[model samples]
Target: MCNSNSLSPVWRELKRLQSTDELFEILSPQSFKWNIGKGTQILFWYDIWVGVSKLRDQFPALFRLSGKKNEHIADMVIFSENGLMWWDIGILFPLNEYEDLQYQMLMSLLRNFKVDLYKEDEVQWTHSLEKVSSVAEGVRVMVKSHIDFEFDRVKVVWNKLVPSKISTFHWLAIQGGIPVKEVLSYRNCLNNSSDDKCAWCLDHIESIDHILLHYSWSHKVWTGLFKWWNIFWVVPSNVLEFSVDWSNGMGIKAEKVWKLIGSATFWAIWLARNEVIFNGSYTCWAVIVSRIKLKVFQWLVNAKVCESFQLYVWSDHPWLLLQSPSFDMF
Candidate 1:
């Protein structure tokens, strides 16, 4: 009898401050005196206030029509509609993005027909409790898994649960409406797009392959490394082939050369495209080759490296193979 049970779990202690009955006004409506404690909860008591009859209808699951019936009702908190259970805080919150997630999850749980799965005529409330607990745990897991990839891409992305870390090249590829595989395919199918001439030949218009490896400029850029490292390679023409065989079948020096060459070629091509578009200037082959040479030389200096790598470099970019004429020992 919540009517007489004005022992509001929230605000009953303050009423004890005064002992006199005159301090409060008791307006009896069928049952339970009201207008107590400065008219607090009077409106709530007037509106949604139910005295057994309405409570039975509104929340039949909690209260059966006939107390002796011992049968479940429509508002049974024990019923699991999908995994959506009575314990879900999702039930009590406003519908927002996160709430939408809850809603969808609940709908999915309902769609699973999990409520009917249990043969027990006696309702089980475990689904509600378990679903809520599971969802809460998943949310925490996902949030903990989120990361900002500014520091170390490989370490950050491949830590444990997260692994799909992207790079600048990936970004550019996205901008071009292409994927990594497509870019590799373009590498292999570097056929002349213009006339009968080969783009790489500089004697003819270019294709993707010409731009990557076969062009006269690219050939020169790679020649130095090839001669130095003695890498024997069969050029590929698609993303899949290149990704698989780009650095395979090569000695340590040859592998290093392939890595450097691939990087230089991709970098040079991207730069050349930008130069052509933004500066309206055609990059000379000699300039491209020289840039590759200078970059390899500088890298060798900085790395103090004299070992093999997994990526590719051109043979002509033999800055690594050549002994440093002078080493500044500090």
Candidate 2:
């Protein structure tokens, strides 16, 4: 009960309460501050070293740590008129490195200003924001934390874009069952000089577009499907052009079909290419069409995939539905 002890009894209460939980009052949405500007009110969870001069001259009760070879046990060292003083700051935390460290550095930048569709946030929204770049990065990080996602499909593309190699999308694609090999090969498709030809159609080297869009076989599959659906058949020549030129001119049905067309078609063609190379076999165009139809229908059926099947629909043709990964789409 003597007032001789350095902390005015109240600080001791705070230190003791920390044994139970964090020093701040735990409110639902945010932490609460009970006092400020007063001698007792403090948001800091740890001690603030008042420096040697202030401690020795102002408060005779507080003790100092030995500053031997900078190996002092105190949490922090302070310089004052008397020279130096060491005081315990708080509990030391663990460490973070690399991308985690970069992320933290990036998050710190959010303090500047971030604009979403129509919203704004300040830098100190959370100290944790210090661990990310923009608010968008923060959101993506939170999403990664809450949900399990991988980026196997786009791994190659993303890795090429990411220096120091921290790939969020690559992980997501992997989790989505996207073939990493394809992602790696997708780059080859982007470069025209590469001999990477369509594995399904040996007549042309496989590039991403060649496999997905312009291959002789892929063209036939899509073209035939479009004709069946009574829609215009306008296939872009390469991935870049396709991205720029894709249209839903065939109406609502075409839009739905287009969504699934690329994925389903590519999946089908890739599977066939494997069959030819590994199995040493090839199917006629008519057989290929039937197989594709069967595959799409199975996917549709199994997905119980009703109204939104259009998300998978392309070219407005039931024929487009046939070209899926496996015959399981029914």
Candidate 3:
């Protein structure tokens, strides 16, 4: 059983040292209705203990009006000498700007769900039949319910076979989360030096699509990859389209290989870009193509996609493995 005074140790351990704002993220998805045994455990402002939503969410104007955003249920509720319950808004607390209807709604909700300080507050999970769930389970449920932008390319970016950092970088690039010059300009991080040009080509702005696809060096890298695979497909205009449409006209096994190799292609280009940006190294298209080949081979072999592929065969005829009769054996 979880401790009645606090959230479960497992959940708390996951967010033990986090700020109150961060704690709201963990608590928001946890369908925990408070059975207030002692009112100390219930957050008066932020908790969704009474209604279908948190009080802060239900009455944002009223919540902002109150000075005690973090006050507990016990702090707000008090008993008279005659044993009647009433709210105590605290000494000199600002309570001046909420609509009358909002206050009436709040009082009405509180009246229906009065807390008992004598009993130890209990937390119940509404998400589970057992009224208990782990932090990881809660997080999974929250993500599944709330996140709306999942895509196949994004899913490929989180492949366990790929390095997490590399996958995360790929995900960010796809989402345009990288701090490119345009982004820096938007955030007012750049001086007026006009240094936002693609390091390889001084013609256009250094957007993610330009850096990964349209720039002269990046184009060469993609063309080189296509030639290596014995495919003459035209490159798509964007990364997502490139990822999804790159494997067209290939067998299922070939498509898997193509997707993994596609990830390697993006990763290699980013590495080359970083090399140029950070180390002031030159962007050699041939060298980048070579690196992409090597990276794809390494990831394939290590991830057990092509465990038996010799380095020499992988170097010369990588696509042959994908088309081989025993390709599934890999």
Candidates 1 and 2 compared by TM-score, better number:
2
Per-residue lDDT tens digits for candidate 1, residues 1-330, read 122233433223322211212222211122232222222222221122323123323433322112221112222235456656441211333455754664455445434222233332221112123422233432343346452213222221121211123224422332232322223323344242122233224353343445545555556655644555555565555322333344442555344434444445456665665565468777776677667655554555455543334113322545434433332220
lDDT of 3 by residue, 1-330 (tens): 122347767665543322223334444434457777667867776565777667767876675456555567888878889879887543244355456567777788778866675687777666644545566676675576674323345555666566777777777776667877755643447664245567767666678889988887888988887788677766677775565565443433476667667778888888888888899898689888888778877877786666554767777788666665555764
Q: What is the lDDT of residue 55 in candidate 1?
A: 33
For all predicted structures, in order, the TM-scores are: 0.32, 0.33, 0.51
Runs in model 3 lying further than 4 Å from the true structure:
1-153, 247-253, 307-309, 323-326
Which candidate comes out best when scored by lDDT?
3
Name the candidate, 1 or 3, with the larger TM-score value.
3
What is the number of backbone collisions in each predicted candidate, taken in the order shown? 29, 43, 3
Q: How many clashes does the backbone of model 3 have?
A: 3
lDDT of 1 at 259: 45
